[model samples]
Target: MASPAPTSAPTTAERIRSACARSGGAMLAVEGLDPTTTPVHHLLDDGSFAITVPCDGSLVATVVSAGNAGVQAVLEMTDYAPLPLREPVRSLVWIQGRLRDVPIGEVPALLDLIASTEPNPALLQVNSGSSQGEGDTRLALMRLEIESVVVADATGAESVALSALLGARPDPFCGMESCWLQHMESAHRDVVDRLAARLPASLRRGRVRPLGLDRYGVQLRVEGADGDHDVRLPFAHPVDDVTGLSQAIRVLMGCPFLNGLRARGA
Candidate 1:
């Protein structure tokens, strides 16, 4: 078999963590409130999440009025394909938790902590606004105390325990996956063609595109005449860095030349 079934891949907990780390799109639906779409969210090291909302938003008002009790909420984080596809959503992580407003004085410290990992510009914006000399900050920071987690993908959906999720780390390549796959699609058509050759003949009947990348392997989307099918080509072994990733990809594409270079550490 050209594209042999992977002996192992990232576990559900790891995948969920990776999805949470790299995904920028999220929708928060609090009990008794409409779903709110926000891009300013971060998964904290402690398995909790922090988000910034408009200071005047209803969510902020609701949390404040509720006080220490907090509001029940479910956050849906979506991981979209780097490239355009018939089905763009690659995976989704549902984080169920209690939503509480973070005190203004503590917002800066939390933002600093989240920035160390993600460093999203929005965090900086919130941080600066909160520390301003005399004014109401436009951004209000809130924390989600995670109670449960569930992740869904092409494979299926699975519930992850809080402890398991906290122990797992995001894939090493997740942050770079979007750009790497985009580069692969534009500058490395020949490599993709070679990879397509490994697909089953039936899947080759339609368009093939690079769907996703991770430490474990590459996932290809085959847009068949009837529908779309996702296929995973696992690496011979899980990779931890770029060098290992390069060697794994070469082996998958059957590029003997590159394999030789990898073997020689060139």
Candidate 2:
């Protein structure tokens, strides 16, 4: 079979934003420090990231000692497949920036601000403290002034500008993407096989698994003897809601009438 022609796809910035939004937390890698996992983090609108760490943690001390100079850091966010696959990692996003600690006095205001947009119980945990143990697990606020953004996924790795990343919006259906892909993998194997027909013969030889979905299209992961290969099957047009997504998937299955029925379902 011939390879399918490419269609409009999400830009690097859009993908970066979406990945960060969907990723609940990230692995924090700072210069001169061992990598640590962050349980609560949020990407601010201004392209900066707000993260929480224990007030008494080594990371907090390191950033505070740096003072206003700030320290270089990178937050690695991983996007995993919703279903069981040979390669579970779907994508990797690196958010590089300078890390600084928000002042104790200013922490409340920052949490409040973040809560207004992206609310998380962790934010509250930062205030009241978590567990009472030998070590104080109370979290403190820290900010990463984003300098660069890069996303490596089925599509590939590309550097995204801070301005473009700030402007780009995450896919509206990103939150539900995992569930949809899970459904396709579990109950709609036939549809997946049909869609695999669109891939090149070389890719078809491998196990074609549903990898991801977005407003633009669906992605497939081809697991073969050599390694894993990612391919995308673009939708005829972008979809916003479930109805449009249903129509697009049906059309991809070469069923135009199903698209009509999906839209008419009131």
Candidate 3:
């Protein structure tokens, strides 16, 4: 398979914004609360939704509905706080953060905070604690985790490149299973096939698979064996942009682990 011709490169911000526009809109049928007390409505020119209720103190939860997807952000709107009292509602924060390029390690803490501040006292608890309860919250958390992994993996390629430049190497490990990893692996194979065709006959056996999805696009493992020694190439990316696939491969090949393998064959 010949590699596709290069096209213009879009910034990470542009790609994320495009994805959010495509998948961000959501409509939610909220239950377990008095419709009259905290009526949901859209605010902001961009269609960001919110629901506010009168409460003693500054404790408030803002529900953002975009299409069928929704995320609840909680805030303790008060004076003199270290971090912003505002926290994302369930997975909504996570999804929005990824689209906005928030860091990965910070996601779990945000999810946990939303989980703790639930079933607002002013509002009725509809499906709260039921088997199917916390549906929106749970879904949001999952989405956040997935998106976080994908974005982190995509953008972390630079770290891997830097490590290669600094003489870092990969230790052997088996692959983990997850939806994001699976998507990345598929993309890796596609890129590998295209690159293999362009390679000189001697390097034809190069293979690619995902090692993990971190705060980059995906960390990949590329392997080849020249009759004797085994060679492994490690790399990362922020997304599966085919036009940049060749550049990505070149970055991976620079890693010391892969460099060692290539030297073995040489």
TM-score for each model: 0.88, 0.87, 0.22
Candidate 1 wrong stretches, greater than 4 Å: 1-7, 127-137, 258-266
Report the poorest 10 consecutive residues by lDDT, candidate 1. 127-136
Which candidate's TM-score is highest?
1
lDDT of each: 0.83, 0.83, 0.30
Task: Count the clashes in each prediction.
Answer: 0, 0, 26
lDDT per residue for candidate 2 within 128-171, as digits (tens), equals 75454455467778899988888886556888888887888899
Evaluate model 3: give its lDDT: 0.30
Candidate that would win on lDDT: 1
lDDT of 1 at 74: 92
Superposed on all Cα atoms, the candidates' RMSDs to the truth, in angstroms, are: 4.3, 4.5, 18.2
lDDT tens readout by residue for model 1, 204-266:
988999998888889899998899998888888888899999988988998777634544655
